[model samples]
Target: MRYLEVTVPKGRRRAVLDVLDDEGIDYVVSDETSGRGFAAVVRFPLPTRAVEPVLDRLNRAGISDDTRVVVIDAETVISQEFDDLLDQHSHGGTKGSRTSRQVLRTKAEELTPAFPIYVTMLLISAVVATAGLLADSPAVVVGSMVIAPLIGPALAANVGIVTGDDGLTSTGFTYQATGLAIVVGASIGLAVLARLAGLEPAGVDIVVVAELQERVSPNVLSLAVALGAGVAGILSLTRGFSEAIVGVMIAAALIPPAAAVGITVAWGMYGAAIGAAVLVIVNVLSINFAALTTLWIAGYRPQGLFEVSPTRKPTYAYATIFGVALLVLAAPLVGVTLVEFQATQLKSAADEEVDAVLAEPEYNHLEVESTEVLLDDDYPLRSVDRVVVTVSSSDPGPMPALTDHLHEGITTHADGPVVVEVRFVVAEDREGDASEQIVHTSSGDRDS
Candidate 1:
């Protein structure tokens, strides 16, 4: 429940009361008040659901500027008349619960803060994300996501489009672009510092840590995450849920990729940086596109008729932009996906070949333990595939012949050239027990 104290000019008292009465709201009017412009105070208690519509109606009735409206939380109301009034106005739907245009506009305006605080949070999040990515720690990465303030502007852009607020849209886009620039720049600076401190790998070769690799190559799955997060974010905002949690979701789709771009850039891996940048671009477009679509579907629009057409123009423009961008991004994602698919197939074939080689007569005592296919360092561009085979045996035979046989088996199924490396783990029987044996290992690489 909310308690509203509204002070309007004497001439506008009836107008305010009429709106309240129309909505079946009960109020107490104190007329002939001794204050500025001989104003009157209308004190009303209302349900939470009715707050937005009632406030919007009041603002539309031209009492917003001159009227001083203060809303206070009401713990309890023990009036039968008020209860009856609420019962009379109550509807069995979400029509009355939707956030008003004024409220949404206020929220958007609040999100576009002064430059200093925005920059501070951006730099801080970037640094935190850099640390997390370097350490390859999920917990640290999530902490950075929570600290990121990027979601505000992201949703603000959607709000601006829905409400036809040019200033809001411009502010949102400006802040979002500026924030991203700061984050990327700060991350690059951190990378430079890390390099100076001997924290990151030197030369053109990137250390293929799990976190770094994940962001450097995006596909359809990454787009799906951004789309879902975007929808979740707008829903949280409209439903009056916690923005912080939703913000984390949005940050997850954004921050790590941005950090990856900086890290790759600092390492002078421009090609890999392109992948990370594409991921970031795809995510940004997907989030905005999803949020805009969700808001439009949720029945949010410009309040006035004149504002409606203008709102739609920008909506279509933004939608088209995002759609085209997504299409452009799909090319790279599709290529990456195909490369991954081929790699998977190659790895599977190599594993089968290793198993077949182990089943041969001379290698019957040996078992194929594990197999992995390592792609070229500059994958998707250079197409060299390395098949590493790990095998264990109690009674080992000559490795040269076995390596040649394994290589032949793999190359038969491989679409391109493959480098086969056989790692032999010779296990000796201990105390006449074959199952429980002491093991000695020797590795040899044979390229074909």
Candidate 2:
């Protein structure tokens, strides 16, 4: 519910009052004595969802650019008629619950902080994210996201573009670009410093770190995170949900990968850095694309553009640009997906071979433990580097022939050269038994 106050211009008071009366909205009219607009002031109460459409009607009824309209929250209304009006709009779905463009625009602007503060917050978050990635601490990484001021600029850009506020749109874009650049730059500086101070040892293999490894794999799944974040962020902004939680989600898609790019580059792993860089780029584009589409579908459009063509033209243009850019960036992600799929198939086949070999009578005492598939750190697409299988047995023997047999069986499923290694773990029972336990079987009987 909202309490609204609108100052009507001269000669437009009757149309305004008639529109209000037609909708059964209750309002109070007072004569304008300040002599600024030379008319009457109308105060009204409305359901939150009814504000936009009712305001549009008032506009068509001759509200001018100089007209003053103030919308504020209304806690309670005692009128049964107002309750019926609220019930009607409540059943209208998204359009009913959608925040007015006036309010939405204000929220976007408020979310965007001052320039200096924005940059400072961005740098701090980036440093924390970089440290968290290196330390492989998910909690710290999430903490970094909480303070990130990224959601504001990210959604504001789309909001401004959809509403045809050119200045706002431009400022939103500038803030986004500036914020990301600062994050990347700060991460690089910090990572390099960490390396120099021996916090990260020389010649370290950064990919071995679990958190950093995830950022280097830019697959189709990565796209979903970014798209979902963008949609949720905007929906939260317009639907009166907690934007702070959604803001963390937006940061999750961007901040970690952006930091990974710097970390990998600082470690001189240029190929791996490309993967992280592509992920960051793809996420940014996908988030923007999803945001623009979601806003349009929610029936938001340019306000106060004076002409319909001028309003719709820019909105369509911005959407098209974001959509096209996202598609272009998705190419590499698709490639990565295909590579990962093939690698998975190869690993599954290797597992089956190990199971079959262990089923043989001669190898009945050996129990399979784990199988690992390693891949190269390449951009867009990576290939299997090796497959290692670990088996456990208590028998005191070399088992070198098992390695040969396993390698021969696994390589048949590979399209190219893939190294296969086998490891044996000696087992012992709690009863101090180090000998193998074997079960002997006959045609119709089995014995242990």
The candidate that achieves the highest lDDT relative to the unseen native structure? 2
* RMSD to true structure for each model, in Å: 4.8, 6.0
Q: Indicate the residue-level lDDT of 329 in model 2.
A: 74
Worst 10 residues of 1 by lDDT: 435-444
lDDT of 1 by residue, 45-143 (tens): 887556766776877766755567777668888887677766654675323434555566676676566779888988899999998988888889899
Tens digits of per-residue lDDT, candidate 2, 329-429, equal: 78878887887888899899999999999999999998998988778756446788877787888775657567777878888888787777666766666
Cα shift from native, residue 325, model 2 (Å)? 2.1
TM-score of each: 0.84, 0.90
- Model 1 stretches astray by more than 4 angstroms: 5-12, 32-39, 64-97, 201-204, 379-384, 394-401, 411-415, 427-448
Best TM-score among the predictions, by candidate number: 2
Each model's total of backbone clashes: 0, 0
